[model samples]
Target: MPIANQNLFNQSRSFYLVSILELWQRFSYYGLQCILPLYFVWQLELTLADAFRLFSTYVALAFGFISVGRWLGEQILGIKRTLLLGSLLMMAGYVLLVLSTHKNGLIYFGLATISVGNGLFKTNPVALLSDIYNRTRFTLYHTLACLGSITAIILTPWVAHHYDWNIAFSLGVFGMFLVIIHLIFGKHYLNQYGTLTDQQPVSLKVGLLVSAIITAAIVFSSFLLHHQTAAPWILVVLFIANILFYWQKLINLKSAMRRKMMIVFILLLMVFVFFTLYLQIPTSLNFFAIHHVSHQVMGISFLPEQFQALNPIWIVITAPMLAALYNRLGNYLPIPHKLAIGMVLCSSSFLVLPWGATFSDSSGFISAHWLILSYALHSIGHPSISALGLIIVNRMVPAELKNFTTSMCFFTFAAAALTAGKVATQTIAPLYANSPYISLALYSEWFMKIGIVTAVIAVLMVISAPLIHRVMQSNQP
Candidate 1:
């Protein structure tokens, strides 16, 4: 048997070498996200509606690519080749981004390229880590991954707000070059983690059908919900077809007969609901921050994307403390209790942001400090949910199917972004059109309303928490 790598804590080794390499990739990814809106509006001169819609589409499409990636990793390419090609594609993407920004239509094209690269690259990194560590140690690996995300969130906005957006994007180009180096040298560190789930062969036709069907469902879901938009007729038809295909599989699979699969599928659906609300932080909140809040600190105006930086900042400061607290509380405090508390914390953050929105007069802007607090509270709320989520999914799924299941978890995230786009069209768009200045107050009211909804989700989760815990624990050896 091949010797397992030594423990990271005991040895001078860490997943950090890999984490640092991964960090640069995220630096590029989040850095681009930070500047995308400004580039669209300030540089590309899109209307706020146009910019928001387009931005929403870019993000929706980004996560959507992961399903494509998951397939290739399993069937045709395998994770190693897929991840390498993805890394190179991302580098070329950054290069193309620089090249694309100068030409019309090219920026979206460039983002699509980068998003595809991420679909290809992002999934495998954690899968690689899984190959190295056990469930308990995987917590530490996840912490490292979370750390990278936090670093990107804080730094991306700071780079953009401090410098020009193009310069911010240029930093991505540099980050990608670094990724090329890391992937080349880190071959020895990574090659051991061979593709675990690639053994279950899936055909290209099946994969393509899956993609086509999912696309159709999203479209049909939008239509069934009475969302009025300019989507073409052909597109709508396809959307319906895709929904039917998935619905049939869901019914036929009798996943309940497979206990673990049923629980996972349900959890994924709940996560979808969570993501719909959460994804709004990027798209809808962008406008909410730009228009509603009052602010000035040392003459710097806080932007919406900057709000996203808040959660990560919280994670960096609070994760270790929370980890420590969990250790101290272990064997006494119930996991459900901890989770419920976190969910309440999450809802209140939104509640606070809306309060700030309402407080701002049509002409009177609110201070950035309000936003800062909102973000901080959100930061606290996130790690609580995230830590629990990973634990549940990892422990419950069959060992061999972990990659596919994890991809489903992220798929919820992507689905949420897509749902948020639709929600944006429903809530924010109409409110803005009807009320205009009055919409600010309406949104504040809406934020508070959403908080109630989130609190309910938290409450429901709390009530069900013991049951979930029991189900998860019983499934394990």
Candidate 2:
């Protein structure tokens, strides 16, 4: 092969490897996520409030550590080694979870391990990919991640139902084991990328730094797990710290890059909002489905957790089409415009739920179709904002800042997860306890309020599109 062709092949090959690793990683992560709420409620016998608090704290810490992971990948272990370390840790975490069946206290330790592992694993792949390919390819990668999520969502529930929770948790261990194996074998293909930090010898000082950070993360995460109320306040502190860090970075950038970074900051705030709403799927929405939505469809009864698969299933179907459409349109549809549309779609998804509730049968169970439709809308809205925001942030920043900015994006998600947890605790949990008979009605009312708020934000985004677009495009050749 010619040099150019060989390089192209290598790039595509490396991308495929990274995407597959992401698939398996998400498989473990989402599989665990789908079962966690139910596990908290049923097996652990926790109240809804406590469950949401724990769930949110686990999620928050998981994404929160991405910054530390990015630093590890960039300054200490380098990408490949860090990825391997993370996978191994995640596998161990799952093992602990499996053992939790015997001693329930193990679950907290297990969750903390997974949170740190996920922090280390999640951002590095996208950072590696940005080096190999342009933004256009990211949507396909997102689809792969969604594919993993849907697979886990469908399988975990069935496994837990028929077999045991330990076995289901073991599936995560299996998934991470695949990731570790794949990374070891696939390291050869990625030798040309993400290796800068690996070239340096690990001095004792640097080694100690890495150790200290990792130890701190695990300790702090455990603290948050035990003191769930502290999670939100800590999120506030982290949010402020993030803003300060970005503000410093913004002033240092060149004119065009500065404008782009500004846009990234704005869009990240939107990301927080979008994900805060999106995460309701696993938390509040899951509970709602369990309590009010009929599980039967066409004479088949589905697990509540299985319904979570619908979002990813819709993504699997829609992502390719949307990618093609975006390519066809080129610059005609700007990022802000797409984000606005996404917000609107997300709003509609929630708005429909209230209306759907009114159609419930005598048992107070709404049709499963309503949940399906809501997920469809939510899934369609996802790529427009979530995936696109990632692409934009990666593309806009300088190469040196790519991993940091990517980690920052995950930080927003971390904050949003905590916010979503708080929302569920405040909005959904209270209704369940205080108004048992009108719980569904109250849930619908909260959903309606969220929908209205999101719709307003979408309109504001639409109005701001021109300025954001101009700022983004200015000083470009």
- Best-fitting candidate, measured by lDDT? 2
**Cα RMSD (angstroms) for every candidate in the order listed:** 5.9, 3.0
After the best TM-score superposition of candidate 1, give how far the Cα of residue 370 lies from its true spot, in angstroms.
2.7
For every model shown, what is its TM-score relative to the native structure? 0.78, 0.91
lDDT per model vs. reference: 0.64, 0.85
- Give lDDT tens digits, candidate 1, residues 117-141: 7877776766555565644555455
* Superposed model 1: Cα runs more than 4 Å off: 1-14, 74-76, 135-164, 196-262, 294-304, 331-339, 357-363, 397-407, 425-439, 473-477
lDDT of 2 by residue, 1-477 (tens): 111123353447778889999999999999999989888988889888889989998998998888888788887789887888889889989999998874656788889989999999987898788777777677778887778898999999999999999999999999999999999988877877775886667788877887787778777887879788888898888788878988898888877788888888888889999999988988889988988899988899899879999988998998889878877888899877888899999999999999998988776789999999999999999989887777667667778777667767877898899889878875554533554447888788899999999999999999999888787667662
Which residue pairs collide in model 2, if any?
A: none
